[model samples]
Target: MKIPEARGPVSAGLLDLLSGQPGADPAALANLHELVTVQLRAAGDIIEDEDFQLALFCLYELHYGGLEDVDDHWEWNPGLLGIRQLIEAPFEECLRSAALGCTTETRLPPEGTLSSDDVAAILFGLAAQESGPSMSRYVAKKATLEQLREFLIHKSIYQLKEADPHTWAIPRLTGRAKAALVEIQADEYGGGRPDRMHSALFARTMRGLGLEDHFGAYVDSVPAISLAAVNMMSLFGLNRRLRGAIAGHLAIYEMTSSRPNQLYGQGFRRHGFGAEVTGYFDEHVEADAVHEQIAGRDLAGGLVEAEPGLLGDVIFGATAVLAIDGRLSSLIMDAWDNSRSSLRAAVPAGL
Candidate 1:
């Protein structure tokens, strides 16, 4: 992806800065920050605010794949980092507040330290809760061809680069946590066979649907909550301060992945897709089922036992995903139920 269509004044200005020479203009940066500040003050439901979420999404994108026209030097530019912190503050506060409001088992052990098994059990219990409508069951039974395509488009924003956001936590971990993460990541990366990589499998799924398979292909079409869900991962992963939260995020992610993916594959088969099309989801069913065990017991549990302080953050990470993803599923299901598109607008496939 080249720089996408700017969603607002802030994004336009920020894109201009990134596309320009490194250290090009301080005045322009100041103006972008000013626009962002003004927008944040009046921005209702920041999670649903297109401009705010888009601007923040672009800010995080710098750390991932810098825009095609963007100079790499901008990734480390202090002004940009400062602007990143500006939006991140509120986004994080919103997430933390939402996590606090979630009803689930996040209780810590009485001894103030989790055993390898203790941490796993807490995460498992959290994953097993029914917090919202089941998008998986809906896809398994009722989704149309167009609706399935729409679902893929929404997911393409992240699935095309699956496992990357969480990979940021590898170096931040040590001992069993570190080893366990590497074990999980190896499978996600296809364990030495590129075709088997989760991202590659997902891309094949997109191609099976006759949709674009490149990263950021349908980003402009997805809604704010979609962006917000992925942004939450980047937020937890990129911040060293939130290392525990990132670990927790991955545990919940794996624990919840298998069944939904199975249903997703079933939905595609309902449309007459073969193994090539459903491979990605089918692969996850087995992979995540096994991963949930290692992640819960060894990765998450070991981390808490090694560093007791992260237990709260670990649970926060798990519940935060539950809360955020529940909202995202609700957004998709409600739109589909009403015969409306979940995207910000109707975008033709393969755009």
Candidate 2:
């Protein structure tokens, strides 16, 4: 991915640091750290703060496909790692607070033990609750071709790399849980068929509408909350300690995905697009229906049953999905409701 245009001073400084030698330059890192501290302190809402979110997104990007022209050595640079840690601490706390507000009633048995079924039931209940402002309904019933294109751009940040984040937890898991995750991810990765990988499928969807399918091509066009959504996945998946959170994240993700995807496919078809453009959403409608069961029962539930103490983290992970995604959906719908593009900038007119 090309290095994104800096969102503010921190991203600008981080991009500058990456452009140079990848080393512990105390003065440079310290200056960047000071900028980060000040920015974070001044941020009214870190989740929607462009500077912090963009900086964090760039930091996590190093661990993924990496930025264009950035040295591979920076992936493990101590100074960069410290900067990432500084941002992650507050970002995580913000997520936890938001998630707790949503899942206050979710609890485990008094014995501090639960079967896989019990855990799945709790997650299903969370999924069943009605969150306000449905993006799927808007896409299905009313989105213009341009709004749909804007929708894809917001999604491109994460969908183009679909399933990679949760895959991080596979090695961190064991037994039924590991098997379940691998099972679901196998489907996501197209079961060894590269062309059929979910990312590739999403790319196909983008091309059908004449949008750039390259990962992160639309990073600059999306708002901070859009980037924050993807960063949350990386934050949970990369840390072994957050294995439970990642598991629950995937579970809720799969649980909530099927219906919206169905509606998304409908929206595209309503715009007169054929399977080439709609296949990605059509595929998710069925795949996630099955995946939801496996993820809720075997992946998240199995893990919590095996390690009882992780129940809170598991629930937290599931609810965090709701909190972040809810905010993102509302942001998009709010913009659209008022006759505007959801993206920071409008995408080109599509084919």
Candidate 3:
């Protein structure tokens, strides 16, 4: 994808340097890190801070499908890593605080030797307790076709690359946890049918709505919190030390998904969309019911049982996803409720 438009000076300078020849001076990158430190210190709510999130998103993108003309070698440039850490430190702290909330005391099971079933129950209970104004319900009963387009654009940030984030944990785990993750991912990948891959399914929905189907097609339109949600998963997944967190994260997603997906499909169908557009949500309604069990029990619970010490991190991962996604949901719903567009930039015609 082409480098996105800069959201602020930090992102602007970072993008400028990223376009330099492979081997831009480490000292120059260090100077850019200094600018980031100053910017973050004065920022209010870094979670919604567009410049910070965009810069972080671009930096992380280096490890994914990189920018159009940027040098791939920057993926590991020591200077770039230093700058990334500068932003990551505070962003991670904010996420931890959001995840903690009042649930910290009750986030985990009592201390003891717990079986996978026991752990699964705890994860299941966590998901069941998610009660609030929901994006799904709005999508089901009220969203206009334009609002639905906004909804898919917000989701496309992550859905376009579904399962890739959690797949990072495959090599980091072993035994039941490994097998469980692979099984879930296999289905996400369409079990050997390329066209049925979840990402492809999502792209079809985009096109059915008269939207572009390419990855990153709408990145610039979504708000900071939308990017932040996806970044949280990547943060947990890419770090081997956060293996437990990523496992818990996927489990939370599967556990909470099935019912909401049904509503999402209903919303699209209410507008008379056929199988072509609603297929993504319809697939999830069925798939996630099965995935939730494997992910919560065999994947997340089994990992905690084997490692014993990662239980806290597992809970953190689950709650973090809830926290981040809640923010994104509110962003969209709040805008809709007030009769405003939720995107950072207005979507163009037919989008």
Candidate 4:
């Protein structure tokens, strides 16, 4: 991935420091940390803060495909990790706080008595609750060609590398939970067929719409809320302690995906797009219907049954996704409702 344009002082400093060899300038690292501390203190909502979100996004990217022309060693630089934690701590707290409003302890069964089937029922209920604005409904019923393209741009950030973040939990899990995640992920990776891989399918959709298909191609085009959505996945997946959260995240994601994807395919088809342009959504419409069952019943539910103690984090993960994604949908729909671009800057239309 190319080094994204800096969104603020922290991102700018991060990019600048990453341009050099790791540990080459200790003073620069120190200054960067100090900058993060000061900015974090001054910031209101870290999740929606452009500078912090972009900075954290870039930092997490190093663990994935990495930044272009940046030092690979910086991926584990202690100072950089410290800076990421500075942002992550508050951001995660905010997510937990928001999730509180979306979930309740009464939703889950008593600690040691919760069965896998019972946990699955609770997760399905959480996924079923009607929340804020609905992006899928708008895309299906009213989005124009330009709005459709902008929607693809926002999704491109994570869809281009679909199933990766949650894959981190494979080693952290065992028995039924482990097998379930692998099963779901196998289908996500097209069951070993590279062309049919979800990311590859999504790339085809992007090209059909005359947009860039590469990962991170549109990182600069989205807003903080967009980045926060993906960042939340990375946060849960990367931390071993949050393994339950990642499981819950995947469960909710699968549970919620099928119907919207059906509507998404409908929207694209309504615009006269062909299979190549709508296949990604069509694929999800079918795949997630099955995936939702396995994820909710075997993956998340199985995990909670095995650990029991992680029940709270499991619910936290599921609700956090709804909270963040609800805000993202509202942001997009509100912009479109007002006749504006949902992206940070409008893209060229007439593709």
Please tell me which predicted candidate would have the highest TM-score against the true structure.
4
Error of 1 at 147 (Å): 0.4
For each candidate, what is the lDDT? 0.87, 0.90, 0.88, 0.91
Worst window of 10 by summed lDDT in candidate 3: 101-110
RMSD values for the candidates in order, in angstroms, are 1.4, 1.5, 1.5, 1.4
Query: Which stretches of candidate 4 lie above 4 Å from their native place?
Result: 104-107, 348-351
The digit string of per-residue lDDT tens for model 2 on 232-311 reads 99999999999999999999999999999999999999999999999899899989999999999999989988999888
Judge candidate 1 at residue 6 and give its lDDT: 78
Q: Please say which candidate is ahead in TM-score: 3 or 4.
A: 4
TM-score of model 1 relative to the true fold? Answer: 0.97
Worst 10 residues of 2 by lDDT: 342-351
lDDT of 1 by residue, 1-351 (tens): 656777777777777777788777888888877877887787655766677777778888888986787788888888888888888888888888878766564566586656989888888888889867998999999999989989999898889889999999999999999999999999999999999999999999999989988898888889888999889999999998899999999999999999999999999999999999999999999999999998998889889999998988998898889988888889898999899988887575453
TM-score of every candidate: 0.97, 0.97, 0.96, 0.97
- Cα deviation of 231, candidate 1, in Å: 0.8
Note the clash tally of each candidate.
Answer: 0, 0, 0, 0
- What is the Cα-based lDDT of residue 246 in candidate 4? 98
Global CA lDDT of candidate 1, please?
0.87
The regions of model 1 sitting more than 4 angstroms off are 105-107, 348-351
Q: What's the ranking of the predictions by lDDT, best on top?
A: 4, 2, 3, 1
Candidate 4, position 29, lDDT: 95
User: In angstroms, how far off is 203's CA in candidate 3?
Assistant: 0.2
